[model samples]
Target: MRRQDRRVHTYLLTLFFEVLISYIFNQLFYCETSKAALTSMPYQCQELILYGSVFADNLQDLERRLTGLCDPGSTEFHEHDLSFSLRTGTDPDVTIRLRRRFNVDSFTSHQWQFRYIGGPEPDQKCPVIVRKVIDSIAYSHLMMDFVKTLGLRMDYEYIAKGTVWTNGRMKVVISQIQRTEKAGHYDQSNLKRFADSYLVEISACLPDSAEYSATAKQLRDFADQLLPLVEMEKVDYWRK
Candidate 1:
């Protein structure tokens, strides 16, 4: 009887451990799957962009007007952008842009912006530009290496010094485009401006369910306010 009792106890112990191990493995697998599902869901984005320029002489006036029109506590930024292109040869090239800031006054100094912009919609009748845009914020710099490993080649790089402001969902940026005298060099002192005017762009990203008419009207009204100083209108980039 003693030997039989010992055997029963050993079997129970083995069964209990097996159950415990299975439970632990299932929990780990579930957690990992949930994380993957969340990350795989892409952000639904839409935007309206209008570009124009402010002459050096009228820049201060434009800035003052923007201050009064937009929300207070605007941010000034200096950024470097690298454009990478993935060529499949069979289809159109896919471009991804990576932007990082330098001499930033805000807490987002270490963040890298990974941006993917889809081609403009075929329907030109839409007042606002509708396209697929993914803007991912990554803290680690390993993203550059990961992109390169995907067979994307660096196409070009540039610098933008700008001030950003927000009014509700609308974001306004006035920047000066600059280029390095030597390729791949990002020094501020060595940068040369593309032109004497400041490039003004007003844009916003919205979710899939956003009403297009209301958004377009709002953009049009706000853009009208910046008139004479800068004319903001939809541009056909591929027309050239």
Candidate 2:
């Protein structure tokens, strides 16, 4: 009788432990799956912009290099065209436009841009625009990298006006200009007076279905790539 009781007790203890282990494993698996789903949620980005500037002296040289890249005979050959338009009014605006259409392996013609601006001078202070319809989040990174590589080569100066991420409806914009001095040494007055001072604006439109967490992470990743090329403290706008 004593032997039978001991056997029964051992069996019950083993069953209890087995049940506990199964419960813990299930809980862990559930938590991990939930986390993965949250992280991997699809974020379709419709557009992206990585803005920067260079010294006025380098604008002509930069234009030449960019034109060469767009030239059909050049190794970086891309189908492109150039157009110009001027606004005559109280405030005259002159825009030199360079439109590049990209058609490469696995990339569609939809991926193109009209990078145009007035001048590189501080007094001109015109923002160079890179408007595009991005194919994917990863492609956005590559596009920015291509721009950054070219800009760096041309000794271009990159200023951050702001980094924007949107889905045509909801939007998230991280701007460093917001935190700068409002009325002191680094105030808008002082920044505007600086010859090299120019604003950089990067705007993008994502799919409405994109998860905020994933989209934010992608934006942060994009920002990370610019860290070495931009002021560390200024790029910290995303963190805030």
Root-mean-square deviation (CA) per prediction:
16.4, 25.0
Candidate 1 similarity to native, TM-score = 0.73
Alpha-carbon deviation at 101 in model 2, angstroms: 4.7
Report the lDDT of model 1 for residue 227.
84
Residue 222's lDDT within candidate 1 is: 93
Taking the tens digit of each residue's C-alpha lDDT, what string does model 1 give over 1-240? 477775666455434333422343234334435533322222437766766789989999998998899998799888888888654332224557788885523524435666666556565666656655656554442556666655778987878888999999999999989988887555556788899999998887777456566777788789889989998878765342
The top-ranked prediction according to lDDT is 1
Compared with the true structure, what per-residue lDDT tens digits does model 2 show for residues 126-210? Answer: 1221122212111121333443332322211111243333333323333322222332233334333234533333344555344
Pairs with backbone N, CA or C atoms under 3 Å apart (clashes), candidate 1: none
Count of clashes, each model: 0, 0
Model 1: worst 10 consecutive residues (lDDT sum):
35-44
For each candidate, the alpha-carbon lDDT, in order, equals 0.68, 0.33
Clash count for candidate 2 is 0
TM-score of each prediction:
0.73, 0.21
> What's model 1's lDDT at 131?
56
